[model samples]
Target chain A: MTTMDHLAEQTKLERLLQVDEGSLGFVAEQEVQATRAFRQQLSEFYYQRHQDAFHRLAGLSKLLPISASAKLAMNLLGPVLAAGIACELPKDRAAKLAGRLPTDFLAKLSLYLEPSRAGAIIAAVDEDHIVEVARHLIAQQEFITLASFVTVISESTLRRIIQQVGNDGLSLLKVGFYVEEKTALNNVVTLLSEQQRRALFLAADEHSLWPAVLSLLPYLNDTLQGEMSNLAAEGEEQARDKLVRAVAQQGDWYPLLLSWTRMSQENLESSIRLPALHEEALLRECMAQLEKHNLQQALPNFTELLTEEQQALLA
Target chain B: MSSPIETLRQEGLPEQALAYLTALPEEQQQTLAQQVLSTMQKKDERVEKALSRALDVVPAPLRRTVRKMLFS
Candidate 1:
């Protein structure tokens, strides 16, 4: 058989291995051996029609376990497959190729090539496709790893793509549930515009929002703080304290104190905490300044530096 | 003769006197033994206060173990 014919035969055997069930253990061992042979064949197949070779390789990937298939596809195709896909691969063929590959394999492949190819994949991937793929991966409890891969895409473009997907995009976020989603969303929020960030904050459940806001606090700028303060204004006292604590922890204690000062005297006394001595003397200095200034005039811009424990003490 | 504890305590030994104490000679170690005693005493007292405060905040189920470790 010619080299091309031999490779085609090997690809046929791999496809059979995927569904064959005589003995899983024997098939798994044979598949590994076949994979090594396929790698050698792939090296020679490099000069042939790239699309034909990729179609065969995608077939081979399906025969292996998802993890093994993903690794093999990455090793064999890597940048080359991505480049080929980026160039005028017909849309039907591109979709077919994407459909055949495992979600993890597709995600990894997206990372290998030029940024433009990655962008193309992100743009080409419809919201349903993303949600479907994300849901499948989440069902397998691998969303954390998947989120790490998604973060590899350039942040601005990622934000745009996700925004285009809208509430449907939230399905991907929801797949991982609150804590996991909060970690990932914290990353996504940092990459988003102020408006986009606010939208996400407003969309999240109340319990989820507190932790998400706390995680984002250290990284938030003045604009985000203003948005957060507005959001907190509608929440209950405990929720407001959570926001204040986050602001204080982020080194915006002056603004936090100012916000508290503007509350009715009873509320202010009930909610805000003073700094203890051992917990950074700077906190005490801010407290003294707050005391010195008229409650209405000098409070807004002053920031404090209290540790959480100290703040708890004062509270 | 100044008792070592008295001397160290007078010098604000626990916070500001760590450096000076470490510089003393081996033979002088016995002379400053009481300073070590006073330091331990103060540490024990502070630890007790911290434990009591922690107990007030921590839920009841966790307080017993936390108190044992704190006192010990």
Candidate 2:
């Protein structure tokens, strides 16, 4: 590796070490193995280019947090840590940590640790601290229990948390929020709760909201379907024409079309008609695209919406 | 008698296959099984031709073993 690469790796390792004890323990174990693999690769490269390797390592030591002596110490001790201490320390500490942690933190932390009990402790930490730790753990991809964290934290609270974390924080928050929102939306739809469905619909304007809506489609009730259909019709002519255009540009209109079809089927006369005065070509193009994508499975109630001719066209 | 692979495939096992593949170590076992199954299907005509050609040189007992190994 070049000096810059070595420096970068060391910085990452330092950052990993600086994390909370629970996170540090997890990362140290992962890094010890990764470093061994990296060292072997570096050694092979060094053998082929001795001068290059020496220069890189020399420069890298200068740039890295560790002094040359420390690097040497790590080179010697890292294996012992990774193999013996890393494995052994966490097993006991993790249990102690879990017993001390709160229920919410324990839940989130469980997603990252190997033995479920250990994870429970890491997750059980204080909520604010857990959020910070979770942010760090997520950056390292160490914590796998993100879905659990979503249940305890509301979407609005998650959004505020992301705002505080800044842009990079927002990106991670978005991923976690998307997963959580989708699960919550699906849960609401399965329960067919009117209030929950309306809440999800209001939240739908955000890009992060689509996954939740997509997930809920299969379980959507007639009331929810009709609400979405009305939104689509109203949205098409609203001042926020840009939003409608964006949805249209997404190419695969299966979800919207399927929802609309279901709503129309449920309340055939009351539902919005395909405006006869509108462009027939646009509607035809969408129908053709749906057929091309073979998305008929999403529109199982198409027979109720279309006439024999249109039904045949779909077939 | 159903083999493990056959039983798995018959049980609408794609979901299970995906879950197994996700959880498995990045070793050759999972991928190799998939590759072998796909190749067996795609090269069925060539396999039949090769088997017909082999019957002339090999005894029926040896042929059965080869057939079972390749097809299974």
Cα lDDT listed for each candidate? 0.42, 0.38
lDDT of 2 at B4: 36
lDDT string for model 2 (B1-72, tens) is 764345335533354333432343444334423442443343334324433443333356666654444334
Per-residue C-alpha lDDT of model 2 across residues A57-113, encoded as one tens digit per residue:
223223323333233213332211111111223333433333444444433334323
> DockQ for each of the predicted structures, in order?
0.01, 0.01
True contacts kept of 2: 0.00
Candidate 2 TM-score, true structure as reference: 0.34
Q: Would you estimate the TM-scores of all the predictions?
A: 0.32, 0.34
Give the DockQ-based CAPRI class for model 2: incorrect
* Model 2 per-residue lDDT at A7: 28
Q: Any runs in candidate 1 off by more than 4 Å, and if so which? A: A1-96, A102-117, A137-212, A215-224, A242-315, B1-72
Q: Which 10-residue span in candidate 2 chain A carries the lowest summed lDDT?
A: A78-87
TM-score, model 1 to reference: 0.32
